[model samples]
Target: MLGDRLGEITGSVTYQRVLRDDDGMKLETSFQATGTFLGVSVSDVGTYVTVLRPDGTQYSEGRGIMTTEDGRTATWTGHGLGRSDHAGAASHRGSLCYQTMPDEWARLADVLVLFEYGVGADGATTSEYWEWK
Candidate 1:
């Protein structure tokens, strides 16, 4: 597992479609992800799919595994949300966090990683994350 403060994920959008084009837009997207943890390469992170609505609400689900550069593996399923940020240009900001077990990681089952995303109501985007001990 990549803990909150140790690993970071990079995602490539694999699919995207407009579900609703009305004023409060709705979009569906899929992503192919990769990551890094404290100088270690974590590969084949997983596939992530999400639906985002103008109401500052987003729901996501994903299944993937992490393999350290040295070949240790950890798998997990994740789900999370984004809520309207009350003070930051109305951008919805929140986290998609989860836990997993890496074959060689001590306390493998206790890692919780969080990935955060945000889109400003003013037409901008932001991201961040942190995890538990």
Candidate 2:
């Protein structure tokens, strides 16, 4: 993740697949962030563990899988937390679709985009776009 000095945030992320069972797949990710935001040395840390099915459906925090009319597509109920300057907890909920790409290249492209957008520079945004060769 990378941001501006006004809130400059930059970091590297590492993800590990920890468990795969009949229930689903579990991913553990760690992020190291360091930067300046709000005139303060912004240093934060956190981790996320997501359980997703082979079809890309996630099950956690009241989110689950829902099928479309044709049954060819699956959608997930989404939820997350918001970062705040004050110490508190925030929550979010939304819906997302599951898509299957044709090849590994496509899959990799999608992952790269996600990382970039997740950590791209945006005022008040904690994440910024990342690119890899």
Candidate 3:
């Protein structure tokens, strides 16, 4: 079994764009983050999209795949609840759970992860993640 500190992923926003619609423009952000998993460095590239509804609520969806340095890979999804600040940066609180991985990395299948996601007015983004025992 993997311990509490299964690993950490640290990356940056690779790109971000806005799509305008009737309600408002949707936000799309992509990032490349890397972390240590199972004693090896792993990398992930994923995207998060958010839409502000007419009722003043926010909906978000995210998906990403992780690849270990040696070639094993696994997929993860981020489902969250969010709201925008007065300045328009989205503040989100959510959990990220993952699918199965290869035999060598299968321990990740039972881990629990929670995170705080923040997108600043200047387009800078930061995330803090924790693994629950």
Steric collisions counted per model: 1, 11, 0
Q: List the residue pairs that clash in candidate 1.
A: 4-131
lDDT tens per residue, model 1, 18-93: 6554444555544444566545776654554555655667666667676777777766666667555666332233
Model 3 over residues 23-112: C-alpha lDDT tens digits?
A: 586878888877776567888788988887767667878998889887888888987778987897777877778886768755557766
Badly placed stretches (over 4 Å) of model 1 are 1-4, 17-28, 83-100, 118-129
Q: After superposition, how far is residue 133 of candidate 1 from its true place, in Å?
A: 3.2
- Per-residue alpha-carbon lDDT of candidate 2 for residues 1-133, written as tens digits (9 for 90 to 100): 4222223355555433476767666655455565543333445344555565555444332222222222322222223332212232212222222243223224223232212113322212244322222
lDDT of 2: 0.35
State residue 74's C-alpha deviation in candidate 1, in Å. Answer: 1.6
List per-prediction Cα lDDT, in the order shown.
Answer: 0.54, 0.35, 0.75
Winner of 2 and 3 under TM-score: 3
Report residue 112 deviation for candidate 1 (angstroms). 2.7
Ten contiguous residues minimizing lDDT sum, candidate 2: 88-97
